[model samples]
Target: MRYFIIPALGLISLNTYANVIQYFTGISYANPAELFKIKQTELIIGGTGFHTVGKFEGSVLNFNTGQYGEGSAYTRTTSLLPYGRIAKRFNEKTVFAVDVTQPFHSNLNWDEQAFTRYAATQTYLTDIDISPRLSYSLSKQWYVGAGINLNFLQNNETNWALPINPTASANMVNRTTGFGTGYDLGIYHVFNQSNFLGLVYYSAIRQNTSGTSMLANRINPNLQFNFSLPATTVLSYVHLFNEKWLTNLQVFVSEWDVNQYVRFINTSAPPPLNPDFTFTMRFRKSAAFVAAIRHQYTQKTGLTLIGVIDHGPEKDEFRPLNFPSDTQYFLALAGDYRVNENTTIELLYGYGYEKTFMNNHVQVNGQNLPFTTGKVHLSANVVDLRLKIQA
Candidate 1:
């Protein structure tokens, strides 16, 4: 059950608008090799809730003269994520598990009075993944697992854009829902009773989505697009120094660049209308590193501390008002306590701080706006609780 803390640490939130590593950073909820070794049926349930509050201050360039003036933005948001997993031991050499978790979720709401409102007043994206896996023990020290994932995605955006009429602006609303599939492969090795290593790879999934385009009524039937979810790879090493101390180190890479383009297709439009139109945001690949330490304080209680650093996605000169992300640092602490022979509980708290980023200019409705310089800073925290049942 101690391994549960590893993934919970990632529940911390910050400016991860592109591809939040926390969502896809963990191996299977319960390692197959570990489950085989324990030879017990286990069920796990947990949830994390994050409350984020921050300020964005920057300057917008005047359209006519390119002069810059300073302005500030503020936002407050809350995100709740819940997950469940069940691991079954078929026999000594075979183990199986199924997990349902939130892989991606983002919600941003900016002050309506800020200059950035024209680009994005509010935006939201949510995703869920269901994975079923089976593992086979190759030998006493080696085990391999494979699984398939079914993913569901949803996106919503609200902003003010240029209307056909030059005298007034129109409020725009867009919504989309999609489904995709992918696979997972993993290998686990036990060097000794106290040392272990694991590697896992998750494949990319393609989403072909169709949704209502209320603003594009002139374009005919509606809107459809292709969006690719990124692939991820994680390597975890666990070491037990003694009966009272343990440590884990994890490094992961996310190929967010696979999400190259989001081309919108309007099949009902005129002959001159092309099916492919590029969206505004461009995402880049990134990586994350985490180090965690656990200590047993008593017969039924333990404490763990974790530190994380994430390399954010590459930034573009044309910033998406709703998507402001950058490199970040996070710190977390967890407490695990055994309430009975069959039940255990864990509580976690985490904090995240992001480095400030700058943008020289912004584009809205095909019009260029210059800012002497604009910057964004973000910070967030999370609280999580988990329960484990073993038989």
Candidate 2:
């Protein structure tokens, strides 16, 4: 069929849907079951046809600290994320889509540097995103969609210290990347075919950075900081009984109290800390629940099973550099094979578990750090492959 719709739009255009929330904080009830079976109309062709989806993931993070260092440490990771998408259907009542992915990657690293030497021993964070969407269907139940989000960010940090006397020895590097734009809105409703409801809103993404500071050129170079991306809301629901069985629920709210303070324009500043340090932070709202089951072990072959529950984000907004918050659980298995009636092949596997909380602080440069309070455990395993064609 048109070469299986050009590899199913090049695999849903390497779709990353914001990593379902930047690395699964939760949400992705299989994305409305692939947008309701690809907006069928017999898979609409002339009405508009284009699709692509791609995904690759690997993760591991473990840390056990009775007081930091000399205890436990493990952080191994791998990622090869990609996405590209373009969809069109304008006659039967408009439907447009545009996609791009590479949602976050700052080059994570750390095989040595056992703890602290001066903060960062190695750091890298990356991201790239572009999305354009339009959906309208004020009839058969109701629908609405709006999108425009562009983002590109990079962050880097390096450290090395050895000042016992040698002229206050030094070696510290910090680099930050930039580019940002945001706005996203979504609404979906369908009280028939089975049941569905969705609501999404995301806004608040700002990046403006310039770097340089080998300890500020030996102790006072020029440095700047401005990185913010906290404003989100999502509510979802889905239900399908007969035809196979599926259920999902999601909720997320974030404002992070506007994530106050990170500014350091013009360099030199580190003594006025404590605006309650932003209420110490410990959860700003996140909830998830999912269930899936589909079987059609006939015609061609099909099977799907998924289960998840994630509720994370708390513990003083923990930031051991960045990206940390645990309370996750997962189990997934997917399969689909159809070498005829067009073409189809898909497989997926998943397993995850997480729980983290740590605290121990004292810094004004006086250094007494031994951060890490309680439980900290994480495990993840995922594999996905896809090939779909129909034209």
Candidate 3:
């Protein structure tokens, strides 16, 4: 599972009339050939091997609401992700692979007196994903693959505030969980021994989440949020020039229009909330470029330097509150070592810088609220280790 921590206090109470936030959790890349190249295996194996991997990510948020009615909120989250994969060659023309990964984990807390009297705290557990893929070699230079994905999700929320008097306080808690499934397809073509092109398509996955909400003085009934996982298309290319230079390019497009509504059950006669809530999320897209060079000073060791750029998509009003929409840039470096024929290790370090703009309005409980419009900056560092064995 992946864990995210957001500090959203100070920014909520600031004097800002525009606020916009968007987030994307799936942004990891792995190359099997690179791993195999570092660990030369000769166990007469016709299938792929398995290994363990982990990741960590963190971020911060700040905002101000304004004068007598200003409220501030801050949050932070952390998550540990563990996963494994297996691959096999059924024949010279067919290959099968299965991978299980978890990339969603979160810790969020928000406090603001301008909108409500209480401070809200939420802990969300995103669904886990299990995928199995099958590939067919149409020719020596072309291949196609398809797969299925299953998901599981859970969440909990709590609110704290005072009743009629500021001296007395109360608490409310809510929790829910659900499951769903989806599919994916991919095609690739290789040219020479150093260049390749590939494309992947992901189908939309829908989750019908059900949960309960409880207040200090009342039972808020059951609530359901119909979450529609957007469909994505990715086109990628990789090139290797000699043994020292390499480049990778990828373009991603997602259909956010399918994310249409949030259905609440057992609240009030008319829902008692924002009635003008219309689904307006249209399209979200991005492009990424990576260029790296490796220098080998010895037969067993080498150093690689990489740089990447991510161009974010246009602003959308229907984006969820769980993700912050922003564009980012990354710089990374790593070292690879070959530990004989069956073992290898790689160490990597990277930093990301992000920027976002907030100029949208939101309506809650028949009230129009103004938020702060500015730029949010984020910095991140990452490390990864892998162990491979051939049998």
- On lDDT, the candidate that comes out on top is 1
- CA lDDT of 49 in candidate 3? 15
Question: Root-mean-square deviation of each candidate, in angstroms?
Answer: 8.7, 19.4, 8.9
Assess candidate 3 and give its TM-score to the true structure: 0.70
Q: lDDT per residue, candidate 2, 30-109, as tens digits?
A: 12212322342222111101121111111211121213343344445554444545455555656666555554443333
Q: Which prediction has more favorable lDDT, 1 or 3?
A: 1
Q: Rank by TM-score, descending?
A: 1, 3, 2
TM-score of each: 0.84, 0.30, 0.70
Query: Which model is ahead, 2 or 3, in terms of lDDT?
Result: 2
Model 1's lDDT to the true fold? Answer: 0.64
Residue 176 accuracy (lDDT) in model 1: 63
**Segments in model 2 whose C-alpha atoms lie over 4 Å from true places:** 1-136, 150-171, 175-179, 182-192, 195-208, 216-239, 242-245, 248-391
RMSD (CA, angstroms), candidate 2: 19.4
lDDT of model 2 at position 297: 63
lDDT of each: 0.64, 0.47, 0.45
* Of candidates 2 and 1, the better by TM-score: 1
Worst 10 residues of 1 by lDDT: 1-10
